[model samples]
Target: MKRIPIAAAALILVALGLGLLDLGLLDLGTPDRERFRGMVSPRLQSDKSSDTAPTIQAAGPTYVGRQTCLECHRENHRLHSHHGHATTFRSTKDPEVARRFAGKSYDAGEPFGTYTYHVDDQGLFVRIPDKFGDRPFRLEYALGHRSMTLISLLPDLQSDQDTPRSDRDTVALEHRVSWMASEGQLGKTPGQHDGPPQTAAELFGHRHEGRIMHRCVYCHVTTGEIVGQQIVGLTPNVNCEKCHGSASEHVRQARTMKTPPPFSVGRVDWDAESELQLCGDCHRMPRDITRKQLREYPDLLARFQPVGLLRSECFVQSGGSLKCTTCHNPHQSIDETTETEHEQNCIACHDETTPSTETSRKHTVCPVSPTTGCIACHMPALKLDGLGDGFHDHWIRVRDDK
Candidate 1:
C-alpha cells in the first residue's frame, strides 16, 4: 500500500469542493429513487450487536454500521447514500419494489412462460401461471438498484423479517426475469439460456445452493455472518463499513479520547494493485473469470471492469499510478461525472506537450485528437449481451482495427 502525498490529497479536497474531481465513469445518471423514498434506508445495526455477538468475536472486527460514520464524515456519507452501492441490495418490501410490479405482468415467452407481479398484505409475489399454475413464489429480496433489479425467491426462508433461513440445505432462486430499467418492464435475466429448462427451478430462475446464495448477498451487503449456510445479521447495501472495515472501535476512541489517534482503524495507504483487488472483490478481477471468457467474450469484459482495467496498457504501464479511483469517485454515483471531466485523467498522463524523447516523459501522447474524445476513441461504451445497457470498456486502449 502506498500513501497519497499530503499535497496531492489537499489538492483533491479542493478539487472536490470546486466540483473539478466529481466524476462517475462507470454508468451515467442516477437510479430512480423517488419511489424508494423512506423505503431503502440502510439497517442501522450490525448483526453482532444482538444474538450474533459471539459470531462477531470469531469473525474479528465489530461493525458499527454507517450511521456512526455520519457523525464525522457527513459529506462522504451524503455522497455514498446516493451511490448505486448504497441501494444495490434491499428487501422486496421496499415500496418501489411493490409499485414497479403493480398491475405489471411479463410474458417471457415459450417454455420459460409468463410471470406476473402483485402485492398483498402478506408481501410481494411473482406468479408464473404457465409453469407453477396459480401457485406464486414470494419475492424475498432484490439484488440491484433501479437500473436492473433481479428479484429473489427464497422459498426456504422462515419469514420476510430480514433474517436468513434456518435450514442448512435450503435453496433459493435468482429469478428468471429482472425488472429492466431501460425497458421499464420485466425481461429475461442476464446469462439465461434460450433453450427449455431441464427442471422446475430452471423454469423460474437460476437455482442457488447455500454457498452460492451466501456469495450473492455477501457482496451486496456490508457485513454478515455465514452461519450454517445462512447469512445472518445482514446489513443491506455496501455501506461505509464495507470498505472502511469495522469501525466500532474507531467510533469508541473518537468519542472517549480527547486526543484521538490520527488513524487507528480501516485502510489508509492504497496503491493501484491493492485498490484493484479491493474493488475486484465483487466487480470481478482477471483471476475470477476464465481466460476463455476474456478471449471469446471480450464484450462481456465491459461489466468486469477490474479485469479489463488490469489488462489495460494504462494500468500496466502507469507504475501503479492509474487505478479505479483515477476516474471514479467511490462515494458518488457515476452519473455525477461527464465525459470531459473523465478525460482529464487521460490528459494527466498522455500530455500532448510532453515530447517522447524527453527523459521525464513516460507515456505516449495521442497524435490524433489529443485534447478531447479520449474516452470515445480509446475506451468506448459497449452494450453487453442480454444486458439492456452499455458500460464503458475499462480496458483503456487505442481503437485501430486491433
Candidate 2:
C-alpha cells in the first residue's frame, strides 16, 4: 500500500478535526451558567434629549435615540433590552455592568505575561506585567453580551459634560484576557491569541487607534458621530434607532402635525440584498471578506451568518424574498428563537413531501428527515475555534457526510 504524503496526511487530520468539532465531540469548555445568569439586563430607558443625539449620524438618516422611539414602540423597546446587541457595549461605572472583574487573574504563559483584575471606587482596572507599563489599566468599556465580555483600556480624554470631545487619533488597548461568560473567568480573547505580539498594545490585547478604535465603538453603539478618531454624542448598545434608522423627523412630524408626513423608515422594504448589507455591517458580509478566505476555510467563516448565507443556494435562488429577518426577529434575543422555528422556516420554502429535483419549483425538498432536522441536516452547527460554542452554518446546503 502506498503511504500518503506528509502534507496530505496533515490535511486529512485537519478535515477530521473540523468534522469532530462540527459534531461538538471536542470539549471547548461549557459556559458557567451561574456566571452567565449574573449579567445585568439592559436598561429600558435612555436619557433622551437633543444634546444626547448622535453627533455624527449615518449619511442618509439622523438618529433620535431609542428613548424617543419608546414613545411610539413600547413593546419592541421592552423586548430589545433582552437582546445581545443591547448590551454589546457599556461603561463600567454602573452596577448593571456585565461582569465584575475584581479578584481575577490568569497567567497567559511565555511571551505574554500574567494579567490581574481588580475593582475600585473609580472603576474596574487590569494590570498586565510588561516592560513598558506595569500600572493598573483602567477598563472603561465592556464589549460583548452574556457569552463574553472584552475589556478595553481607552485613551484618556478630558471630561466636559456640555461639549463633545474633539476627535483625534489616539492609542487604546483591548486587554489580552477577556471575561468569558462560559468559564466565568479571564481567558485568552478570540483572534488575539495566535499571532506574536507586534506592538506593546498587542501584548495585552489587540491595539486600536484612529479608524480601528472608531470601528470598535461604531458597531456596538446604536448611533454616534465619528469625529476624526473619536466617537461623540454616542448611545451605547443596539436599540430601535439602530435598525429603524433615524426617526427624528418621524417623531417631529407625528408630534407637531396631526398626521405624520410619509417618512420612509429604513428597512421597511427589507430586500434580501439590502438586508444582507445592513446586517452585514457588523455580522460581517461577503464583501467584508475575501473570496480566497471563504473558499479556503469555509468553517471559520461560519461565525459570520451573512457571509455564509449570502453564499447559500437559498439566498441565491429565493428571488429577493429571503432575508436575515426571514428566520430571525431583530427585536428578540436569539436564545428565545427555537430550533423548531428554524426548521419551520426551512419547510416554508422547500416542500418536504416531494423528492428534491431540478423541477419547475424554485427549491428542492429534503429527501431525508423531511419536516424535522432541517436545520441540523442543512445548516449543521460548526464550532469555530476560540468562539467556545457552535454557530449554525448559515451556508444552507445538504451535508450527508460529517
Candidate 3:
C-alpha cells in the first residue's frame, strides 16, 4: 500500500482531532475565560492607570469609576444613550411604568393566556392561573429581580414538568410582554435541553452562546475589570472604552491634551472590513469555521463566533465570500448617517423570489416581477412587549427558501 504524504497525514490528524468531542486542543473545554499567562504574551501592559491599584467599593464590587473616563469624554457619554447598550436594561421608578400589561392575559387561549405580570416598587414577577377558569389571569408580583426579564413555557410545554433533570437551555425568557401578545407560541421550561428547547430558537438552530459569555462585556457594560477575585457588571450598557482602547493611554493623553486613536475623529478611508473590525470584534455573527475554510489560527474560539457555521445555509459554493460587516455598520448607526436604520443587506446583491416554495417557505412573489426589500426579507418587525421593534432574525438568510 502507498503511504500518504506527510502533509496529507498531518491534515488528516488535525481533522480527526477537530471532529472529536470536547477536544482539549481546540477550546480547552471552557469558552468563558482563558488563563492569561498561558496564552497572552507576558509583555505586561505597564500602562495601568494610577500607580496605585483601585480601592474596593462598598456597594458590592469596586467599580472602575466610569466617571474617570467621562472627565475627558463628555461627548462619548452623550452617544451612549442612543445605543442598545445604554438603557438596554433600565430600572424605572413609576408604578405607571408597570401598567402596560396590568392584568396581562385577557384570554387563556391567547398563547400565554393565564399568566399575569405587573411591576410595582418591588420589581417584575408573575401571577399564574390556579385553574383554567381562574380569572383567566391572576394578579402577582414580579419576582427574582424586578427589572429582570425571564422567558417561561406555557402549561403544555413547561420543561420543568416534562423534560428530564439532565438538561437546561430548553427554556424561554418568561414574563416579558412578548408572552401575552405573541400570536406565535412562546415560553419554555428550565430543564428540557434536548437539543435546543425553545421552538423559535430550534428553528433558527442556536445563537452563539459566547454572546452570553464574557464577550458580551464589550457591548453591555461601560467598564469591565477581570481581576483574580471576581467578574462583574450588567448587560445592555455600553461603558467608556467601547470606543477608546484600554483607557490608560487616553487617560495619559488627557493630562497633556493629546488625542487618542479612537476619539481622534479624523477622516480616514478604508474598506468595510478595515472599518468594521473595530466593532465586529464583538458584534459579528460568530460561526465556527473549520480548518478547511479558515487559514489563520482558528483556535481562537472566544473572540470569533464562527459566522460560517452560524449562517452556513446562506452560503452557496457559487457565491463569493460574504463577510457580515460588509453591509452592517458597527461604530455609528447607518441610519444616523443616511437616515435609514436597516441598511439594504439583501438588495445590494440579489432580488430573490419565493412563491414556488413550500408552505413554510412560500412567499407571494409578484407574477410580472419579483422584488422584496431587505427589511422585509431580513429584519421582519417583531412585536415584543407592547412595542414593535425590527428584530433582524440573526439567522441571516438570503431568502425564505434558505
Give me the displacement of residue 393 in model 1, in angstroms.
0.9
Clash count list over all predictions: 1, 4, 29
Report the lDDT tens digits of candidate 1 across residue range 165-242.
553435555676788876777777765545665455555565554455566677788867555444589898998877
Candidate 1 C-alpha error for residue 247, in Å: 0.3
Which segments of candidate 2 are over 4 A away from where they belong? Answer: 1-62, 96-98, 129-134, 149-168, 193-202, 225-230, 256-270, 352-362, 400-402
Alpha-carbon runs more than 4 Å astray in model 1? 1-61, 151-168, 225-231, 257-259, 262-269, 295-297, 352-362
lDDT of 3 by residue, 113-166 (tens): 345655555554444443222222212222111132332211213234554432
Residue pairs whose backbone atoms clash in candidate 1: 24-334
Model 2 vs truth, CA RMSD: 13.3
Scored by CA lDDT, what does every candidate get?
Answer: 0.64, 0.61, 0.34
Candidate 1 lDDT score relative to the true structure = 0.64
Candidate 3: TM-score? 0.42
The RMSD of every model to the true structure, in order and in angstroms, is 15.5, 13.3, 16.8
Best by lDDT: 1
The deviation in Å at residue 185 for candidate 3 is 14
Query: Please, what is the TM-score per model?
Result: 0.76, 0.73, 0.42
Reference-based lDDT, residue 7, model 3 = 33
